[model samples]
Target: MPKKVTITDIANLVGVSKATISYYLNGNTHKMSLETREKIRQTIEATGYQPNKIARSLVTKDTKTIGVVIADITNPFISSVIKGITDTCTSKGYTVTFTNSDNQEEIEQENIARLKQQNVSGIIIDTVDANSPNISQLAFDKTVMVDRQAKKLRLDTVVSNNRESTVNFLREMKKAGYQEIYFVSFPIEGISTREMRYQGFMEEVTEDSSHLLILEEPGVEKRIYDLIQKAKDKIAFFTMNGPTLLAFMKIVNKTSFRYPEDFGLGSYEDLAWMDVLNPNVSCIRQDSYQIGVLAARHLLAKLKKEKSSSSPKLLVVPSESVIRNSF
Candidate 1:
């Protein structure tokens, strides 16, 4: 195997001192000429020499690494957000360590503690439960929340306008002649996007005349089918997550309920298969990738000690409500 090259080797080949090479590597161009900087960079690149950021961090006390805890890595929305974080962090010469909380409060807490122990300079967390006390109590110099919020905690958070978006979506559906609309929501005990969406719907809806069912568990598919069977007057159905929508679809198929004719389905999370499925699900589409990018930048700013007059802020992204034939 070829021997690994070092910065010293690049310095020697470029006829520059080690200090000069270090300065160039650190992007310190104030004293060095452009010619000299280019020569050192070219030499380093040609030799395939990589800087020892870990060793440098030991002396500088800046690891240049950000730890990220995602609610569920398997979810496309969460994964897209992580991709944004990775792209931004890598470009900024920082590394990322990612952990999955699996939507469990205990697991989420353990992961946060572990990330802190790893000496990550900052954190970008997609909280499993917004109400998880661990999230509120955890202390970090630089932290940002993505796609979730904690009203009790004083921290930077980036999330979509859940209430406004949901309310508008439902209102538009109602205007488009969706009568007897039914909503199926996840149980709201944990730190969840489910809660915000529910709140949004409730605030916009004054009349409780329509059938609105809140699911306490995953087995609410039967209840949905029963409602659809009995409430033949109802025209639309909505679900908060992909799993719930998928389960409901299964029940609909088993019960031989035709789509559009018998019922309509709308989803909150824009899962990949939503478009390909029969009848094509309508949804409120959130920008998870952009949320990730914003969270990373915010946390990095915090880590760099960037001062601002504003207090802990909530960055709200907008959601696009796709009007498919589901309505």
Candidate 2:
């Protein structure tokens, strides 16, 4: 077997000291010429040499790794957020360690423990809880919550205008002469995204018995059948996520609930197939990629030891409404 190469091996081949190689590998160049940096880079490529970021971190005390904990990677929104995190971290000389929580608190805690063991320098988490004790216990050098707020803990948070966006959509529906609206969502535990969205929907809806219906954990056919049966005359249904939207669509197709006439639907987290559907549902759009980018950059700033004030620390980016035949 070929001998495993080390920094010393690269230093010997390149006629440079181990310390100089270390500085270049760790991105801590101070006096090294661009020529020297390029030479080392070429040799590294030719020799298939890989730096041990973990070992280098022992000396510099920076892992150059950030943890990205998301709720559901299969969801389009989560995937977009991960793309942002990966793009930003890679550009900034950091790598991301991703884990999916599946909306399970225990799984989330276990993944966090693993990240902790890896000595990840910081974390960008879209957590299931905004006020859970596990978030506070992470105790990392830097932690940023994306798409959720941890108000009790001193952590950076990014979220969208959940309440305002939903209210706007609801108001548009009301203006269009829709008398009844139904909001459907997955089971909401402590996840702030769903909770905030529900809060927003509630703000626009009154307690009139016909004004609202909220569904939790409905089977695909059941949801569609319910919508088909309950959407008496003019129906406007608000879906909270892609899965819910897709499942609801299955029913829409099966039951022949004509869009805009029998039912009007607005979806959050525009799924990939949404556009291909016959009616192309309207949506409230969140810039999930920007959210991820900002979250990673925020944590990197903390890792850089930049001083920041104890401001409210909640970033609520703007979202716009997308209109389609469903609305």
- Writing each residue's lDDT as its tens digit, candidate 1 over 260-309 gives 77776788878879988767888899888888888888777777767453
As a whole number from 0 to 100, the lDDT of residue 168 in candidate 1 is 80
Clashing pairs in 1: 129-191, 130-191
Indicate the worst ten consecutive residues by lDDT in candidate 1: 205-214
lDDT of 2 at 162: 82
The TM-score between candidate 2 and the true structure equals 0.80
Candidate 2 colliding pairs:
none
Give the distance in Å from residue 143's predicted Cα in candidate 2 to where it truly belongs.
1.0
- Candidate 1 error regions (>4 Å): 1-3, 12-16, 31-36, 136-140, 190-192, 207-210, 217-226, 230-234, 306-310
All candidates' TM-scores?
0.86, 0.80
Off by over 4 Å in 2: 1-52, 151-154, 207-210, 217-233, 252-254, 307-312
- CA-only RMSD, every prediction: 2.9, 4.0
